[model samples]
Each structure stands twice: as C-alpha cells, then as structure tokens.
Target: MCALSSQVRPARSVPGARARPETAHATRALILATFAFTACFYAWSIIGPLSPTLQKHLQLSEFQTAAMVAVPVLLGSILRVPLGILADIYGGRRVFSALMAFSIVPVAALAVWHDALATVIALGLLLGVAGASFAVGVVFVNGWYPPERRGFALGVYGMGMGGTVLAALTAPRIAKPLGLQAPFIVAAGVLVVATVIFASMARDAAKPAPRTGRVSLVAPLAIFRTSARAWALTLFYFLSFGGFVAMFLYLPKLLVGVYGLSKIDAGSRAAGFALLAVLGRPVGGLLADRLDPKHVLRVSFIATGVLAVLLGFSYKHMVPLTAECLTLGVVLGLGTGAVFKLVAQWFPDQVGAVTGVVGAAGGLGGFFPPLVMAMVKSATGSYTIGFLLLAAVAAVALSVVSRVRGDAR
Candidate 1:
C-alpha cells in the first residue's frame, strides 16, 4: 500500500533575501487565473440555466432537454487530458487565451442559430472548449504556488466555479428582456474581455526543469498506469466534484419541475447552493492543510450521504427541501477542496497530467446525473429515485474511504 503520509514541506527563504517580485507574481497569477476560469465556466454552463426556455421553445422532451444541457459537459470532460498536456507544453497563457477565443465562435453561433435544435446542440458541443479551461487553470495555478500553500490557492482558484451560479442567476434575467440569445452574447462578451486580460498579463512560473524533448501524447495514460493513488483520488473526485457539478446544473430544473417555482426563484435558490459550495472549497483546503485529508473526506461523504437521503424524501415543503440542498453544497464543496489537496500532495511532479485525467473524471462525473435524473423522472414520474441513487453512491464512497489506509497527513 502506498503511504499517504507525505506532506508538503514549507519552502525556506534564502537568508535575508526578499523575493518581493516572486510573491507579487504568484498573487497576480492566482487572481488572473481565477478570473479566466470563472469566465470559461460561465460560458460552459450558460445553456443549463436556459434549459427550460429552450425546452419550451424547441418543444423538447425531458430526455432531449437533459441531453442538450449535457453536451458541453461531454466534450469538456474528454478534452481535459489534451488541454492539460498542452498547458504543460505551451504554457497556460497561450492555451487558455486560445481556448477562450475559440469558445467565442460557438457562443456567438448559438446566439444566432438557437432557433434550430440541431444547431443549438452542435454549438453546445463546441462550447465544451470553455469547460476544458478547468484543467488548464489547475495546472497553471498549481505551478504558481508552493506545495504548502497550493491547496488553499487552488481552492481559491476553484471558486471560479461560482461562474455557474453567476450564469444561473443572471442568464435568465438577461434573457427576459433581450431575448434568449442575449445570454450567449453576454457570455461571449465576458470571454472576450477575459481572454484579452489573461493573454496580456499571465506568465508561467519558471520551470524547475526546462523542457528539452517533445511532450509525449501518451504521458497522462502512462502516469495513470503507474499511480494507484491517482485512481483512488480520481474515484473520490468523481463523487465529490462530480456530485457538485451534477447538482449545480440540475437544481434549477428540479426546483422548476417539482416545486413549480418560477425560473427566477429557482435560479436564485440554485445559485445559493452553488454559492455555499464555492465558499466551502477554500475552507476544505485549509482544513486539509491542518488535518488528515481522509478524515475531512470521511466527514464530507457521511454528511453528503445523509443529506441526500433526506432530499430523497422529496419534501413538498420548500423550507426542508432547500435546506437539504444547501447543506449538500457545503459538504460537496469541502470534499472537492480536499480531493485536489490530495492531488497536489500525492503527485506534485505529474500535477499537469494527473490533473488532466482526474479533472476529466470530475467532468464526466457531472455529465451523467442529469440524464439519469431525466430518465428516472420519465419512468417513475418522480425524482426520488435519482436522489436515492446519489445517496447510494455516497455510501459506497464512504465505505471505500474506510478501507483505504495510509491517508494521514
């Protein structure tokens, strides 16, 4: 068994040396990277909050609506590996800027052609480029910070996921007056501005070892083969981050369909869930720095599983249902932060490659739950089955955590 006792040691400063420029660079990188990530995420998830509008306009069934919302997640999940490799080679500035630029085309295309269902789906696939930004930002931010501080730094960067909340809250409001297409235009505009700022300001930290040979395409797969810990972390993240993504995307739909909430009200509540998760991430990272990550994860999974069961009861009372959803947000957020802390702890050298594979798993984790929820609703005429499935998955993850040893910090 691989020991998980390895902890990142603090960097020692040279005697009487003040590296003010380096410190400044690290701060600037973290901020810019976070901004870029937020913009990309906003673009990637823009379609989700607008799903009901599209469903009504296109007269789509539940399954078709779910598929439409999920298309960007599919490409986003698969492309992280290559994008991470590219960030490793060309640096995040070029790769992230190019991704933002490319994403603009689809966002614009969707704005103009959304009347056609086929066009909307096709454009959504292209928008997956925006979702792949997570991997690029992960490698970029990880490279900038020291191991001792990486968990917190990455967690702060992860807050960019609040872009989903931003989309959920704002897109519908924007669509109300400007038309359904206006939200895409707004997202594209944000990307344009972020792309410019990122390209102009971002810089890669000096590599510890300079690259000499070409980067192998198969490097991520090779790393995956060698690291049992990577697989473990991947599974944990698949549950943690995946569950968060799935819920973030699906909450608006759930509120609208089950409780008959207005779009604005549902978006506001969903945004609250996302906001708590976003805030919890940095706290989870901070806790991992002080305690065993396994313990943190144990608490997280247990809480998540229990809450999911409560949600499965499908309370008609808005107060109980909303409370359950928000609590899961906190557990999931912390779980996500702890998982990445482990990534940086266990695989510092292969952060880029491992992050790519693991991030892909996280994205894939978000991709399927909406479809499952739709199918469950179609077959059983209720969402109770979907919530039960989430509880079951969380229980299984909790069991896996207990069996895995050597997770001390």
Candidate 2:
C-alpha cells in the first residue's frame, strides 16, 4: 500500500523570492473556477427541487418521479471521467467553457418546453454535463495549489457546492412567480454569463498539459483498475459526496411526504441542510491539513453512521429529524473535503484521472440512494430502510478507513 503518512511540505519561498505573480495567477484561476462551478451546478440542481411540481402536473408515480430526478445526476456523474481527462489534456479553461456553452442548450430547452416530460428528460441529459464541471474544477484547482495548501484551497473551491443551496432556496420561489420556465431561463442566463467571463478570464495553471499524441479515453480509466488508493477514495466519495447530493436533491420530497410540509417550506429547509454542508467542507479541509486526513475520515464516518441511524428514526419528529439531517450534512461535507485532500496527496501526478474515477463514483453515490429510497418506500411504506442502509454502508467505510496505516495518530 502507498504510504498514508503525512509528508512535510516543501520550504516556503523566501520573502524576496519572486512568487507574487505566480500566487496572483493561481488565485485568479481558483476564483474564476469556483464561480463558474457554482453557476454550472445551479443548472444541475434545478430538476431535483422542481421534480415534485412536475410530478403533480404530470400525475406521475413516486418511482417515476425519482427516476426523472436521478437521470441527470446519473449522466452528469458518468461523464466526469472523460471531462476530467479532457481538462487534464486540453486545459480547464477551454473544457469548462465548452461545458457551460453546451449546458445552456438544455437549460434553455427546459425554459421553452417546461410542460413536456419527454422534453425535460431529453434536455436534462444534456444539462447534466454541467455536473461534470466538478471534475474540471478539481483538476483546474489542483493545478494551482501546492500540496501543502491544496486541502484548504480545494475546500474553498468546494464552496462552489453551495450552488445546490442556491437552487434549493431559489428554484421553488422562482417557479412560484414566473412559472416553471422561469428557473430554467435564469439558469441558462447564469450559464451564459459564467461561460463568457470564464472564457475571457480563466487560465490553466502553469503545469504542462499531458501530451498524449492521441488521447485514448479508455486508457485513463485504468487508474481505477490499477490503483488501490483510487478505489478507496472512490468508495469514500461515493458515501460522502453521494450522501450529500442524495439529501439535497431528495429532502424536499421526503419532507413533503413524511411531515406534510409545503414544497416551499421543505425546499427552504433543505437549503439549510445544503448550506451547513457547504460551510463544513472548508472546515474539513482545514482539519485534514492540520491533522492526518485518515483520522478525519475516521471521525466523519463514525459520526455520519450514527447520524444516519438517528435520521432514520427521527423522521416522525421535526426537531430531531432536522437536527440529524443538518448534522449529517456537516459530517458528509467534512468527509468530502478530507477524501479529496487524500486524493491530492496520494495521486499528485494524476489528480485528474484519479478524480474522474472518484468523482464518477461520487455522482453514482448521489444517484443510487434516491432509487433505493423510492424502492424502499414502494415496498415498506417508509424511507427508514434507505437511511439504515446508509448507516450500514458507513460502517463498512469505517472499517476500510481503520486499516489505513503510516499516518500518525
């Protein structure tokens, strides 16, 4: 196994040393990438909050609604592999611009054809590309920060995840005034502006682009097959980021069904959940940088497992349910930050390729739980089974983490 021990950072440049220009450039890239990521994610997030309204309008069954909501997540997630590789090869500025430009098509289609489920499903597939922007940002940001500061830098870049908070908070309210089309129109506009600004301003870090004479997409995927560390990170992200996405996307539906909250109320509450996670991500990164990330993982997984079981039982009471959900958000957010820190540490040379594999798993992590929840609901008349299943998975992850060696306690 690759050493999990923390290595010392390279010595800081002397005050008289010429690092200012380089630092400025890295900051510029980091800022722009974070903004563009937030915008792209807003488009990715639109469907989840709106799925209930669409369900009511179309008279669809619960399972169908869940599937509809998950389809974009599934596609967005699966595409991260290639997108990350593309960012690594062609540069993040170019790949991110193209991604945002393409996403506008689907967002605009949703605006014009808001009432048609077929149109939404078809266009939704295209819009999912926006979700792949996470990979692009990870590869881009990793290029800028040195290993010593990368954990915190990535956690800051990760603040872009708050885009889901923006969606959960706003999509429902926007739909209230201007109809279902309004939110999509707004998202399209956001993508347009982000694309223009990022294209004009963004630059890849000074790292040399990987010069594969002929890029074979399949070849990059070999990381997952060959690297034990990559698989471990992939599994952790599947739970951490996956759990976060699943809750952000599905909490509105859950609250509405179990507690009888209005769509707007549930949406606002879910926004709170996402917001806490957003805030916690950086904290996790900071902690990981200070302590061994393996220990951070251990604490996050243990706490997350406990919280998941609590959420399963607490649904009947809003106080405990909301508390558990919110706490779970912070824990999962930390897990996410710490996992990527380990990725950056472990695969310094191949962050993009490794991230593609890990990110796809994270996306799939978000995708499956909704389906599982839907199935559980269909058969058992409650979502408890899904939460308990998550707890069990958390336990499994903890066991994997416990074996991590070389890192000092």
For model 1, residues 1-409, the per-residue Cα lDDT tens digits are 0121122121212221221232656788889999999999999999999998998999999999999999999999889888987887676767888999999899988888998778989999999989999889987787667677778888899999999999999999999899998999999999999999998877666432355877676865676775567787777888888999899888888889878988878888889999999999999988887888888999999999898889888545688998998999999999989988888787666666778888889898899999999999999888888988988888888887777656422
- Model 2: residue 105 alpha-carbon error in angstroms: 0.5
Q: Score every model by TM-score.
A: 0.92, 0.93
Give the lowest summed-lDDT range of ten residues in model 2: 1-10
TM-score of 1: 0.92
CA RMSD of all predictions:
6.2, 6.2
Give candidate 2 misplaced runs (Cα > 4 Å).
1-22, 207-212, 405-409
True-structure RMSD for candidate 2 = 6.2
| Model 1 score (lDDT) | 0.84
lDDT tens digits, residues 275-318, model 2?
99998888899999999998988999999899988888877799
Q: What lDDT, from 0 to 1, does candidate 2 have? A: 0.84
The per-prediction tally of clashing pairs is: 0, 0
